[model samples]
Target: MQSCRNCPCTSRSRARTATARTQRSSRSCVTSTRAGSSYRWTILAAGVVAQASFSAILLGLPAIAPQIRHGYGLTLTQVGVVLAALNVGLFVTLLPWGIVADRIGERAVLATGLTGCAAALVVAGFTSSFGGLVAALAAAGALGGGTQSASGRAVMSWFGPEERGLALGIRQTAVPLGGAIAAGALPALSAHISLRAAFFGLAAGCVAAAAIGTALLRSETTKADEHEDASPPLRNPRVWLLCAAGTFYVTTQISLIGFLVLFLHDDRGVSTAASAGVLAGTQVLGGAARIVVGRWSDRIRARIVPLRQLALALAVAAGASALLVHASLWLLVPALAVAGTLGLSWNGLSFTAAAEAAGRRRSGAAIGLQQTFLSGGGIVAPIAFAAIVHATSWRLGFALAAASPLFGYALLSPLAERRS
Candidate 1:
């Protein structure tokens, strides 16, 4: 037995086992080491840039929807289909991207996705026909959905529990900020340089973001960073509740954003540029509200409480805006601003909660699931809102938008009680 232990074959086998153990330990240590505060903020910055790129391109079209319709000689419903196509692409790919993020990490996913978006946007810019435009936008959306889960998982994985709410909140602000940028620039660009130039500009932004993300985004080598757990995200009750609530919440936001400019122009005689400006203001205010509400949740050490409050506030604000649907411009603008703040502010809170409930290993998949439902709402709401306006009136459409948050609030209340 002693001679066998000393044999050359036995020695080689032992060396191989020892080498494997050392490699695993090195990887485990890499993953477990807490990232510095600055590094976490860097992750936030990268995520914001990536998210903003996706939002700017996707939201840019809506800001210039009027120009697209005029150039293509399409009706309102056809315009809605154009907008929905992008989200339809997102809905189709979000889950698969999340699963890939979990397996491959965020760095490759974000860079590749943003780069794909840049390419798709460039193609979209050159397309002459409506069918070509829809196909290109849908392709952009399918690729861009990669950023949603990858960027979200970055914040959730990098920050500790205590600081995640605020971090995620700051991250969430990028959506509205991107929309604000589009509102401020895209419509005017389309007017002056041609719609193609506006699209090229969006593509340029995505290219810049892709470069930044590739340079800065790091893979999580930590077990907490990339390890798979036995439990699937679909099995989490809290995740499902949050997803349902997000569906309703996002429906209201998309409805307002999708139609706000047109509503102001058609109903109040506001110019296209001026109406876009009002929508921009709503987006800016909504972005600020997300930051404030996120910090509020962090201080309270509770997620659902703030979520409940925001949903209620959104419902009330939406109702008030509906009442002002045709009121004085002075009344309507402020009301929509208030509605936007309330309607768009709850996303970070819900996202943070879902991440917590999902645990570190599953954050990517969980966020992906929630986003799928949110994108589903995005896919449906624009067409539905356009139909309602065509059938009954803009008043009915706005009223229905207002009521959406109440249903979100109702779905969330029980979850809050359970968490409490």
Candidate 2:
């Protein structure tokens, strides 16, 4: 198990290759496989494949929640527990997975985790009890949690800072793209056949993805790669700030993801399907926004003035959108879009900034630590929203969501300043 301390990774020159054209393009034609490297892009492909599969399993469960309920006669809370367990799995492993990614090279961890997730998904398909489902999803979560960050690190290593954001954004879209497939297509499969059958099919997808990922994600040294050098960590402050910013961003994000449908039903007087559709549409739009923001951030990476200003603007818009929920249900869609776009758009830039801020070699750890903050928000957000709703209403809940970005805006200013 070679640590980042011992392992030779992509060089520093790769980190700062931020030319004007390449700044926004994550994978430059001139920079394939780094000088002597072999199959770095293959690792990224593996990550995407694994991520897409995990996306299917993660959302597939919820898509067939009703069928699951009918078959087992379970409670909504029981179904919710399955979903919650996924996070619990992820939360518990966040730190260790990061450490592992840093230790063994991101590829080893990625391949191993994907394989483990496939096994979990296989076992989950056979379980009839709610407890079994929880265990299975939790297993999947723990093994699968690192996929997102590790993939980001892999891509960021290849691309210069200018293009890293857009590159990562394209990669990050897999989350929603996977979810949309599950939401839109898996439902029919689940309903048309059986819940157990759906799980079984998804488990098979995991196996195929695992094989793909293992083949793609690997260390360059094995293939005798050449690359430039970069700085090491002082435990970069910009990394921590990005983590903090992510905390606030996801706190708001998870709150809406978990409860927006409920809010639509109770407050806006929409049917469940309609509400779900609205939320789904918002996610799709937000997914696009992520790509846009990533590319936009890449274009302006050299200019600290615009980066800070744009981040601040996102916060302000999010805050204003949160308040607009009381105005009209139609208004809620755009508000959610603004909130989603702002919250998720940071997917590429924040991580790109971390990679740039700490040098490219340690991007895995930077992204990993930042993910800890993001996962921490997942823990706090739903509970907070539940408390807020219990005390008052989801309206107040969203208002709380709006306020978070203001603080994030403040923290990010210093990073943009430092970059300047």
lDDT of each candidate versus the true structure:
0.85, 0.64
Q: Taking the tens digit of each residue's C-alpha lDDT, what string does model 1 give over 204-285?
A: 9888988998888885545554453537789988899899989999998888887888778777888999988888888888
Candidate 2 lDDT, tens digit per residue, 1-420? Answer: 545535445334444564644654534334554532345455556655766677666543554555565677765445455556677777778667766666677766776777788778778878988789879988988887777666766776665455666767677666655665665555566667766667777767767766676666654331112243334333566667777876776776666555655566656787655655655666576568767867877776542344455556566666666677778767767777667556555555565666666555666666667666776676566666667766786667777876776676677776565442
Model 1 segments beyond 4 Å from truth? 1-35, 221-230, 417-420
> Worst lDDT window (10 residues) for model 1?
28-37
Regions more than 4 Å wrong, model 2: 1-45, 56-82, 125-131, 221-234, 265-273, 302-328, 418-420
TM-score against truth, every candidate? 0.89, 0.77
Best by lDDT: 1
Per TM-score, the best of the predicted structures is 1
Residue 179 lDDT in model 2? 60
